[model samples]
Target chain A: MKSLNLQRVFARNTYLISFILLVIVLGINYIVQNNVFELRVLNNNLRTLLPLILLAVGQSIVVIGGGLDLSVGTLVSMLSALLVTWVTPDSTPDQILLAVVLVCAAGMLAGLVNGLVVAYLRLQPMITTYATSFIFSGIALLLLPRPGGSIPRDLSTFYRSPLLDIPLAFYAIALLLLFWSVLRTTRYAQYLYATGSSGAAAYATGVPVRVVRVTTYVWSGLFAALASLTLMLSTGGASQANIGDDMTLDSIVAVVLGGTRLSGGQGGIAGAIIGVMILRVIRNVIFFAAVPTWSQTLVNALIIIAALAGPGLIRLIRRSIGR
Target chain B: MNAQTLRRYLTPPLIALLLAIALFFAGGLINPDFINVTQAINIVRLAAFLGIISAGQTLVIISGGEGIDLSVGAVVTLAAILTFRITGGDNNLIGVGLLASLSAGFIVGLLNGIGIALLHIPPLVMTLGMTGVVSGTILVVTQGEMLGATPALMSTYIAKPLIFGIPGVILIWVALGVVMWLLMERTTYGKHLFAIGVNRTAARLSGVRVERAVIITYTLAGLLAALGGFMLLGFAQTVLLNLGDPYRFPSIAAVVVGGTMLTGGKGSYWGTMSGALVLTLIDSLLRAMGLAEAYQLIVFGGLLVLLIAVYGRELNLRQ
Candidate 1:
């Protein structure tokens, strides 16, 4: 009985379970590739994963707020296109910074459209976002019909640089966590959870459910822009109109693996971050395990499905045993 | 009928018809030749493909409880590839091709239903994962190069006009629509689906087998998707990796625009047919106006959002 109680506690904390899984995966990764934890290799991996990590954070917020953002991928594509087409290598640093601000603003505006349509119009979030994704991609294609542009080399190289023998990615992650931590303590976070858990109930209790939902999407949009920026820096400012379509599913998968329920309410950004790392590490493991190149996408998807179904399977077994 | 009841039954189909007429006039204005008999035939042909796909989507959505099929496009793609492979472009092997494609769809839907119903996975994640697996399987099988000529009979007889300038494919679509209408409007299964969609616990307590209904709904969706793919092969005369790509979002858009509730249980295949025609007419109008492909997509998305918002308002008011 006591053991079951402990199991219940652990089950209640998805973060704890994800951390343990992350540790196990990292240990296996180390065994497979001795240089797995070496700062140089680690930096390269983290840099590659930075875009998805950022995207997962935005997606986690949406899922926690009882919504989904299928448009994030297209939003990433649109912003990245804007960044590359406008922020030329010869442009002054101030111009580049202005471009960044502009892209972020565009993202928030796009997200605001989604938020208003969803909140005020009470449209289905899933289908509304799916429809809007096409618009975003269309704009992306119009912005950069053909992908050929460069951000400054100095800027790209700086994004790769390490601080104190740890990659800049570590610092960015720390900053993200800090931001989330601060946000968590605010009244908005409590309202977000309440609204997501039960919107009617939240409304009855005098929560600004519509405003809360809209703000969450705006935050999601801003983060999607940031993720696009990361992708731009890593890829040396190249842009593709369809680059972010696949990442939408990847972000949602990370959110789920991080323990956020798709139905909404009950997960944190920290777990989401860990989920992204776990996904990245699993990809690394797949590489070292010599999985055939053509089968990697298939294998990755299968693993995700397994991960998603794993907790439910365990619960089923435990319940049947108890019965 | 009273205004409320009449409005409930008539609003979606009426909206769809009005949208089609508006687009028709717009096409006539854009390119004087676009409203003629030839163009009208062409639009029906185009709408037929989408109509078949939406027939399945309409059912899935009507079953409710956040039911959706993200794997529709992927399933159609796989079905087309397998059918082509099985037939090897021979008219004589058509039976084999159809059987192979239909069975493939059935198995995929059965697996989806199992995961969603028995395993308790959310429908979105379940269908999303199914898309990956099915698409990945196609990739692995084709080794990134899948090419097959559609059978000659498919194009010459099935797709092209064979009877008094009416295409066989259009007839098939009409037949499908009638059958589906009958199934939904005149059957116990249809009643059960709506009941479950409206309230699963109530349906269960009232002796409806929710799980079975959901499973059957998904399986039927898979079969219809595969049928749509087979027709696409006939129309296009070839199968490519991305053939099913355009149909994915449009399938959902068509169903939603047809007046089916995104929340499910209150829609009709007839409404879906008109919705498909509206979208096809819009596409024709866009082409006639000489909009770039990018603008076409933008307009499509924007129009979908507008239509859904209008329908959403009506639903809210009724509630």
Candidate 2:
């Protein structure tokens, strides 16, 4: 009976909502394209959303931990620009590896900077992240101009490579999910959640609130680098400017729709995955709906309003009923 | 109030205006055209649109503790594009254009309000979600194409100066500013709005109908954002996809720069007014320098950080 109840709960869980959206999209795609099985096609698009997914997941974690990562999109853009400008085919395999390592390291450092500013300096999370995003993207643009890149053949293949009709992004995503699962079980995640729920309460209970807050940003930054890496591979390269232009909002939307609270301490990454699926599926719907391309924004606005509204509306109904 | 409290309360807007003046003088030194009558008029006109949006933004932020309306940008974009699309370059359709744009925004705003108020949603996350939804809608509707040709009548306002070099756009802005000030100060509804923002629980205790207050504030923001969209259509002569991009956060920045707290409870329309002009001058100066978008963004970022530091440092030290 307990297992059955758990199954029902998971079935209705927002974290699982995106998976349902994925299934629904595939069903529609199969009917339209007349191919019930095209694992490769699904993998390819998921690959495209991979970097964004990473950013979204990372952002979700931060928000859940009581902060917002407004800079994730810009950070990805900056990293994309940095790698494209610094790494070349002639730079040898070792050089390429070194560049990758450096970029990730730099990303972590940037995240630390943001975390410290928010946790120690006690700045507003959104504003602090927004400022850092601008700075990071500036540095990125200083390195490269426009959106052109020549990512090495090996790097591109690894990101886009098909294994048994499944794209590599799926693997990357699976690995990240595993990591998050482990992280969730650890003391760090517990401390992060406790701190977010109430800093005073957490500190009173002997939690290292400041360190957790700062480290969460570090985690967010590393995730951002990973996101940019996947995007760089898929896009074939990056431009210093506007590389991750859309990632910031997309990630935020995903996190929110996945049932994570932006105010912090009441959400998780699992929901972000589903949020990405719903968002991507919605995009696909726009293509088929034959709406004027410009109308896409209007439709997006409505859907987002709906997504954000739905949860609140449900809660409101429950409260009113209770009253 | 004590001196310390007064200074704490006054820093955000005071610093913002000071920065604007500093940037203006700096720009004037670099290029005198940056401070001419024509330039000043143009900046006012642009700031008017932002003011309208921020007017609504201030109310919402005041009303909810975690409240913010990030959907302002997307709303402006949607309204601007729709106004052009329906008008189809025809002057006769100007009224229709305005109606459609406003209606779209209104409906969207209503949804946002419902989500935030009745549903007990955190306004930031709620609006953030709406941004994607609206942006995706833009992509589908515009399909990478933009519309130009705002009703020439609107353009004439900018072209003709009724006050000896003061463009009609500036006058329209001033008029709107006066009206907003009146609405916020003299009206019972406005008082209620202020009450909710300062203290939600206390306001509710006083029978302020907090939910209604929040809903109306968001709806007001929606209308103002649409108005900004309409103005942009006339101002730019083309409804670019990302034209409204700078408006959203800039309006928030302007409001903050002018004296509004992100945590809500206190803000000034006049401060926001000054804030918008200051931001406009900064950008106009940067554009005059013919710098690339990247450099411009970096400078703006640095400036914002500096202002935050100056203002926030004192506050942080106090707390």
True contacts preserved, each candidate? 0.55, 0.62
- Error at B76, model 2, angstroms: 2.9
For candidate 2, write residues A1-323 as lDDT tens digits. 88567657755674654555557765665555553356766777788888878888888878877888888988988888888888775678888888899889988998999998888777667777887877887887887776677777877777777877677767777887898889989998899888788777788889888788899899899999988877878877745577787779788878877877677777778788878877887776666666575676667566556655654565567568869
Report the Cα lDDT for candidate 1: 0.85
TM-score against native, each model: 0.95, 0.87
Q: What is the TM-score of chain B in candidate 2?
A: 0.87
Off by over 4 Å in 1: B1-9, B314-319
lDDT (C-alpha) at residue B192 in model 1? 93
Against the true structure, candidate 2 has what lDDT? Answer: 0.76
CAPRI level of candidate 2: acceptable
- Best model per TM-score: 1
In order, candidate lDDTs are: 0.85, 0.76
TM-scores, chain B, all models: 0.94, 0.87
